[model samples]
Each structure stands twice: as C-alpha cells, then as structure tokens.
Target: MAVVLLLVSPASQALDKARMDAAVKAHLALFSTDDIVEERFAQRASAVDLDGDGVEEILFMATARCVGANFDCPNELVVLAATAGAPGQAGKRLEPDVLAAAQTGYGLAGSEQIPGEVQAVRVLKGTIEIAFLAQQDSPVCKRSFSTDQGRQATTHCPAPGRHTWTYRWSRGKLTKVSS
Candidate 1:
C-alpha cells in the first residue's frame, strides 16, 4: 500500500476558519443545510495559490451532497479567490476550464479508462495533487464455500488503490502535468 502525505503550504496557513465560514455562507443556498457545508469544508476544502497571486485561494472539493442527492451525484471543484474588500472577507467564486479538467480521470493501473472518485487534494511545491479511488470490477463472494473437512472458506474483496493527478499552476491557469 502506498501512502501519500498531505503537506500544507505556508500560504494555506493564512486561511482561517472565519474566512472559510464566510465563504460557505456566501454559497449557503447550494447546500441543504449549514451542517453539510461545514462537513464538506472540514473534510475536503484546501487552501492554495491557484492563481499566480501571493494570496491563497480556497479549493473546495464539493460533492453532490452540497445539493440534495436525489439523483446522480457529481463532484465539483469550487475555487474561491480573494476579493478586495475587508481584511477577513470571503473570496469570490472563480471557475476556470482547468478546474473541470482536473476532475476528469485518466485510466487506472491494469484497468480500463474509468472515472475515479476524488478522495483528496493538496498543494505541494507550487503544484496541485488530487487523489482518487480507482474503482475495480472485482467479484464479491457473499457465501463461503465448504472445505474438505467442513471448514468454511472465507473470501475478501480487494481494496481500491489511490490514483493521483498532478497539475501545474502557471500564468493563472492549471495544466495537467501527470497522472
């Protein structure tokens, strides 16, 4: 098993809870309740300099839960860039084409090209790394087979591996560097 460590950049340290709360408040209508927004923020939000600017921007990996999950749930990469106002003001939404591309998945190891679920995102050395869980079509053995001596044969399902997509930030844009 491979483990990827998440390292927070110095810029991210500037991101405080007050600013995050304000950002969530600005988009409250998107979620069902305040709790969902808080849950997503606590779990998936990351702060990094998406643009070349020195200030850090909030990159929230919002899931379908943000809205009512009545149908297919799609993940969204929400970017909140700092607005010129109060010192602790929330940022304005900045949607770039690269953000959509970041969500797109390349094929996993020894498998067909399938969309992997976004698991984590982090900023490291001026690049963005997004981790995904690659889904595999493995068989699930519900019932155990009887052995020669009446011993039960237990079966287990394989765990999904993490697939990472690396993106480089340049000239106020994100370009896929590797998968």
Candidate 2:
C-alpha cells in the first residue's frame, strides 16, 4: 500500500494598522454598516515621501461591493491619507460645504455619474485630500440637497452601473463627496 501527504500554506498578509484604519474610515464614510447583508471589500496602500520630513505618507485605495435594492451597483474607490503615528486620527473629515464646492466644481449633481471607489488619500500642508472615481462612463450627473440650517448638504449621483458612494465630514457634519 502507498500513501501520499500534502502540505498547504496560509496566505501572506501585511501588518499596517494605520493604513487599515484609513481604509475602514473611508468605507464607513461611503457605506453605512447599519444595513443587513454585509458586502465584500478590500483596501491597499502605498507609502511615499511627499514631504522632506523623512517620514512616509500613505496613499490608499479601497474597493467594495455596492449596497442597492437590486444589487446592480458598481464598486467604489477611495483615496485618502493618514499620519505615521496613528492612522485616520490625524485626518479630518471633509465638511458638507467643502464637498459641495468640490462637487459643484466637478459639475456632478442630480444623478451624475461618480466613481464607486476611493482611489487615494493624501495629507498636504496639514490638510487632507481625497480622490475618487465615478461609476458611469458617459456624462455623469451630480446633485446636492440642503437642509434648513444650511449647515449640512447631501450630494447624490444616479449612475446605474456603479453601486458605491463616498462621504466626507468636517466641522461635525457629513456630506456625500462622491458616488
């Protein structure tokens, strides 16, 4: 009689807590975990010396499944940055007005096509910048809604292909930055 033996190896993983937290914050900003039926997602980061401080800044990308009624939305991309000591703790969320300004500049409102994921985030001159892509390839539609207080603004995109969106908070208000 003859016997055979096989060995398996576990997948390799990176140990970067700061990068992970930035990705998670981005995810929470985009998609609320309050809903049922969890979605699959992934995030990665690349370190670069943006400044001459000899410290490496992180540029991260996050992708996740969209939460929709029919499950027909596209993936999301988010780009963000965090300091070296503690991840995400140093970065400030974007304000609704700031997001509105950016969206207005991009001409994305009232059912525009926006990127589904956050592709990158960076810190520059003590400020945080976030970059993202839209879902629709054609003319994208973007819109914004305002409340009575004028302190909060909600942005929306109506891209049929993509299923994810992004949010930014600043000064204690949350606004939809991209979708």
Candidate 3:
C-alpha cells in the first residue's frame, strides 16, 4: 500500500478525494457491480513527479473480482493517473491505451499476448515501475461486458509461462519493458 502525500496545495484535500473517487468509479465501470468485488479496490494512491514539473501526480490501480463461475473480469488491472489541480479541475485519466495494449497481448513471454497482472507499483529514481505477473495457472484478464441490448463474453487463454514483465513510466504512460 502506497500512501502518497506531497507538497499539497490548500485545495488539494478536496481535489485528492475527488480524483480518488473518479478512479474508483472508472474501475467500477469496467465490470458489472455483481462481478466486481468492491473490497478489492482501495483508496491507496501514489503521488510522484510523473512529469517532473515540481508537482506530484497521483497514481493508483484497481482489480476486479473473479466471482461465481466466471474465471476473470476486466477488473484485473486498471491504473489511473491524476495531476495536481485546484478544487474542480486538474485530476485527469492518464491511461486508456493500456487496455488496448493488454487486449493485444503485447509483451507476453509466449504466444499469449494478454497483458499480465499488476503485482507491485513502486516509485524509484523518479520513475514509476509497475511489475506484472503472468500467472499462467491462474485466471488472467478475461473481460465480459453487459449492455442494454445484450452481453458479450471473451475468454483469454491461459498463459503458458509464469513469467513477469516490468512496465515503466515513459512520457506519462506505462510502456512495457522487454523482459
């Protein structure tokens, strides 16, 4: 659990809470409430100089619940980023392309391109290092969606290797590093 507190502004108190709420909501939107384990998502966050402008950016990740008969959910790895701001503005989502990258199975060790699971997030040397685990034996990120008209199901094949990949912050985005 990362507790981030930087040189906060007077309005930062409200801004931080608002950003956290938005992140949680974004995570919730990834899956149906019944499939989401509300307790898995926490308010823990990381504050760092993601852009190196003398201000700290807020970062967090959310996980989905694999409940009942479902193997996995889109709730696996959702990372949110927010910049410093006053009252009603400044906190914004920094990563949506991550989902696309994961869906394509970008940096897997084998043919399984499904992205890996986030195991840890640490800020070191002024950079955010996110470690992902390819838990081959466990359920990966198989996302299902339900809409007003109907529902869609996608099953990501299980990975063959229990390997790992580390993605680092590059220009405000998580770029998967070669393992």
Candidate 4:
C-alpha cells in the first residue's frame, strides 16, 4: 500500500473539541466498516498547523487487525486538511499528501518477526518528528544439538532499531528535513 503521513508543530492548537469531533466523525464515515468505530480513532486525533497557514490540519493514526501473532497492529498515520467550500459553507475534508511512509508495526519476515512500531510523533521547533522502531536483520545463531547427533538449528533474534523521520512545510510543500 502507498502510505503517507504529514504533520507539524509540537505546540498543537487547542482546537474546538466539538468541531474536531464532528470532523473526525465525518472523516470516519468515508470508510464503511461495521468493525471500525469513530471513538476508536477519535481519541488519537489532534490539530496542528502543518503548513503554518492559520488553518490547522487534523492528524490521526488509523489502525486495523493485528499483523503478527503477537497482536502487533499496523497503523496508518493520516493527515486531513480543511478545504474551504462556498462562502458560509462548511469546509470539505481534504487529505493532504504526506511526506513519508515510515514503517509502524511488526510483521513476519520468513519465520522471524520484523520489529516495527511508531514510538512517538511530536512537533519540535517548526518540524514534525515521527520516532519509530524499524525492521533490521539480527545475527543468526547456530546451535548444535548434541542430543540430535550434531544436528544444528539456526535462529534469529532481532532488536528493533530506532529511527526518526523529520519533516517541515516550506513553499506550500512538505519537505523531508531528515530521516
């Protein structure tokens, strides 16, 4: 899947909770799924001025069923921009193109669980920081089974590596400051 996310500012705006709630409900309505509920994603929503434009953007993480036996759920970080409609009319929901598709959950990779998860997402200075644990290969261990007459078993134990994707808005476009 082509996944992307956008964000800005550590100092999030104190948006109208009622308005944000309504926006979240409206946004969730786009997906017709009996299994998904508004409250499930609402609590994770926030408002940030990603472009420094007076208007704020909605940031939320969408999650689904577990991706691994350990119940590691996958998350899609979504950013919704408010679009102005006819004068005096409510703005339309516009999902702005995001900067990166950083991994945010664990998955099975050839019998080994690849470590991945979003540790934290925060705005620092004028940029957004998405801290996560990404997948990386571990050293394979070869064990000799004495009871099995020299039979050997290979095992892999990987430690998730920490990573951060930093982004900022410049010239009406989202730019990757670092990763």
Candidate 5:
C-alpha cells in the first residue's frame, strides 16, 4: 500500500512584497521592524487608494502558524495605509473606537452586535465616505462625515460576518460618529 500526504505552503499564501513594501514605505514609516512581519510569502496584499491620494495602500490578509510570542495567533488581517512621499513611513493605527466597531457593532460605547466589513474609503470635498457592509448582509452601509468635524462611524454586518469602523478627525480630536 502506498500513502501520500499533501502539505500546503505558507510562502505561497504570503502577501505581496512589492505592494507591502510600497505601502509600508509610504505610510507606515513609524513602525519598527519588530511591529511588522511579512507572513506567508508574498500573495496576500491587495493595493488600493482608499483616500484617493494617488498613493496605493495595501490590504493584506494571510493565515499562518503562530511563530511569535507577542500575538496569540496568526490568523489576523494586516491593514496598511500608503501615503505619498518617503518609504517605510508608518501610517496611523486605527483608533480604539474604530477598531471596536470593526470588531463589533453599536460603536465603541454600545453593546450591540453587528457583523460587517469595511469595503472602501473615499474622500471628496473634505468629506469622507466610508463604504462598508453592514448588518443583515446589506451592501450599503454608506456613511459619510466630514474629516474636519471630529465625528466617526462604525459598521457591522449581520450575515456575511465582516466588520469595519471609522473614526474621523474633528476639531483636533478624533470622535465617533456612527452607532
């Protein structure tokens, strides 16, 4: 009898280096090398200009075995922002409210559960339109707010299982605008 075992390769599932490098250099120059790690190989980076700033940010997703002590696991989405000028310039980390919304619904201070995902971010005439998937598996949780108004919104889905929340800059402070 003959038996064969198939092994999947992690490198084959890694984010794209060209794209990751570009994004890291563009917006995340502040992060130290210890804070960032290129997982899989180079096949997990999707580039897009979220703010329409002409710079391509990277959306990296990958699954790998845990190799470090800092994190509990390796199944996580590594979101990156790419800014114009300079390489290795670290982008800003998402605020707690935004992170909370992305993970759950009902904003940061609420106790409601909504499944969702952040689809896209667009800036037009000083206002930022955060397009995302919201509760009940709807594809139209289109929320808009002024980046200068200090209000932010959070998004959650009900069926598809995706979440994303955004915090806006207003009056020199970041605030939550969505519930």
Candidate 6:
C-alpha cells in the first residue's frame, strides 16, 4: 500500500485586498470629509460569510459627528458590512457592491446611530454569528411646566455605551440576533 499526502494553504482561503479596498471606497462615498470613518483591515473577511450566500462580506467601522456640545450626542463606532453586488452608482466608472450596508447616514438630522466595534465572527453549526460592541443610548427625559405650553418635555442627554451584541445575516444584511 502507498500513502499520498495533500497540502492546503491558509492564505489561499483569505480575501482579496484589492476587492476589499474597492468595497471600502464605495462605502466611503456615503460620508464626507467632515465625518470620521475607519476603513482598514479591522478583521479578516474570510473569517465569516455575512450574507450566508456562500460569498464572504467585509466588515469595517465608521463614525460621524452630527451634534454639538448641547446636543444629546453619543459616540458611536459604526460597524459596516459589504456584500457582492452591482448596487448602482452615479460615477463615471463601474463600481461593484462587494459588501452589505444599512442605516449608515445621509448627511441629515435625526438619523439612527448604529456603531459597533467588531470583536469576532464565528460560524457555528452552519450559522454565521458576529460578536461586537455597539453604542446604545438611553434618554433622560425631563419635564417642565411653561405658561405658554403648560407642560413640556425635553431629552437632556442620552447615556450611550458600548454594548455587546450578536448579529446574524438575513436578507443580505446583518440583523441583530441578540444583544
């Protein structure tokens, strides 16, 4: 009897850096120079499949400063995922959607602040589970009486902190599985 050996390389299963850069660039279009965004190798894209479609998704973090000192602002670490698609662009060149994005921002007021620091991603029992710590704000409501309005309500500030969350892929996006 003869014994045969097979060799497998780990780097072969890794993600392409060029593709990751393209996906990150596409996502950066959503923010302007005034915003604070972190787009780099936060984690390995090959670690987990974000969309459960056999293809991998890239995850990154971003931040935006919308409020001033008086506003009830919370520091957020935005967790973003990019999927494979031809999402649609208005540029002179062709840009493919290589990630999944949701509820980031559009340079407007009263937008949702979802920032998560990606800790780890694990594929358990064929289910992709992502672990992260995101921002969560709880408003401190205050009530006051006024002559003109009789009663008024005001939200002074929101206590935001990094909360642990477990998210999964659903419908081409990362949905909160548990927090």
Predicted structure with the largest TM-score when compared to the true one: 4
Give the alpha carbon lDDT tens digit for every residue of 1-179 in model 4: 99788665535535676666566555544433333221223336677776776666666655443311222233445565654333222464434311011111111111111234657878755576767675542211112223446655433322447877776654444556776
What is the Å distance of residue 60 in model 3 from its true position? Answer: 2.2
Ranking by lDDT: 1, 4, 3, 6, 2, 5
Kindly report which residue stretches of model 1 are placed more than 4 angstroms away from their true locations once superposed. 1-13, 28-42, 66-72, 85-114, 136-161
What tens-digit string does per-residue lDDT give for candidate 3 at 32-82? 456334344532355455555544445555454455534554333334444
Q: List the residue pairs that clash in candidate 1.
A: none
Instruction: List runs of model 4 lying over 4 Å from the truth.
Output: 1-14, 32-43, 66-74, 86-115, 135-159, 170-175
Q: Note the Cα lDDT for every prediction shown.
A: 0.48, 0.38, 0.46, 0.47, 0.36, 0.40
Per-residue lDDT tens digits of candidate 6, residues 11-114? Answer: 23344676555554555454544332222222333424444455444554433334222232332223334322354354534333322322221111111233
Q: State every prediction's TM-score relative to the real structure.
A: 0.47, 0.30, 0.46, 0.49, 0.27, 0.43
Q: In candidate 3, which residue ranges exceed 4 Å CA deviation?
A: 1-32, 35-40, 68-71, 75-79, 83-118, 141-162
lDDT of 5 by residue, 41-148 (tens): 222345444344444334443333223323222322344532224322258576543443233211111111112344554443323334445544232332322357
Cα-based lDDT at residue 50, candidate 6: 44
For residue 167, model 5's alpha carbon misses the true position, in angstroms, by: 11
TM-score quality measure for candidate 2: 0.30
What candidate 5 gets wrong by more than 4 Å, as runs, is 1-43, 67-71, 83-179
Q: Between prediction 4 and prediction 5, which has the larger lDDT?
A: 4
- Could you arrange the candidates by TM-score from highest to lowest? 4, 1, 3, 6, 2, 5
Backbone collisions counted per model: 0, 38, 3, 1, 27, 8
Per-residue lDDT of model 1, residues 25-87, tens digit only: 444233334433223222366556666566776666545333332222334455555544333
Off by over 4 Å in 2: 1-32, 69-133, 137-179
Judging by lDDT against the true structure, name the best candidate: 1
Cα deviation at 18, candidate 2, in Å, is 11
| Residues forming the 10-long window of minimal summed lDDT in candidate 2 | 104-113
